[model samples]
Target: MMIFEKVKSAIDMKTVAEGYGLHIDRGGMTLCPFHNEKTPSAKIYGDNFHCFGCGEHHDVIGFTQKLFQLNKPIDFVKKLNTDSGLNIDIEKTPTKTDISEYQKRVNEQKTYREYEKNAWQILCDYLWLMREWKKRIPASPDDDLDGRFVYALHHFDYAE
Candidate 1:
């Protein structure tokens, strides 16, 4: 396998960020080292980082390169290997089973991420609908309140 591929496959960005003294919260966010900010804007994924505030985006090696002001990616790779003790065998060739396992892992991660995003979006939409329902008050004292409003009253807090 190539050095770049081997390095990326072995080392996760969270480890790199943590090793460099960046504290990642439960949401995988940290105060961006690239810029000064009161709140954490950089989202660290397994492979990369994206800063919502400054529009800075980079993969693991790119991040390390920028963080250290290195001239070349190879230099960053070397640092990652030697300093981080990743111990990725740069010249090792992947077997068929190794390739299949890696692909399977990648696919599973992609599927899980998609499911998580979809679920979060669905919950947010449901919350909004419940809030809208709660606003539907009856105009007359004798009239019955909207059932949706009652449902919202019962479930909004719990759902939230």
Candidate 2:
């Protein structure tokens, strides 16, 4: 089984919350840790927790990730195994290098999208400028302004 599934099945959210010093009542209500609240607004179900005060809801794994500020599931599972004595294998898990490479690719794609958007906006502005120049120039065939506007349009097209 995957580490996430294994750890999730072995661990109980209420027990983990209590271990973290949260007082859970009989109705599965506790003070929200994500936000300050005088009344109990966090509800702990069988393997999940929901905080009404903070509008945060998460399963056991998500709860652990948030509570400990962990960014990876493997780290959360490892912590659970060390702290709660739950054995979960980590041999087949993806390495940090793979995750970093994926993140880099995503960032590159976002940059390219931004570049494309800017290029499109520049093209639109140039087109609008050309239309406005046409309106300002006289109807005579020999108008220097018309030639200059055409030259500007041609330059912008080549630059793009």
Quick one: best lDDT, which candidate?
Answer: 1
Worst 10 residues of 2 by lDDT: 98-107
Q: Which stretches of candidate 2 lie over 4 Å from their true place?
A: 92-160
TM-score (all chains, Cα) for each model: 0.56, 0.54
In order, what lDDT does every prediction score? 0.82, 0.72
Compare the candidates by TM-score and give the number of the best one.
1
lDDT of 2 at 137: 52
Error of 1 at 61 (Å): 0.5
Report the C-alpha lDDT of model 1 over 53-86, residue by residue, as the tens digit.
Answer: 9999998889889999999878898887665555
Model 2 residue 17 CA deviation in Å: 1.1
**How high a TM-score does candidate 2 get?**
0.54
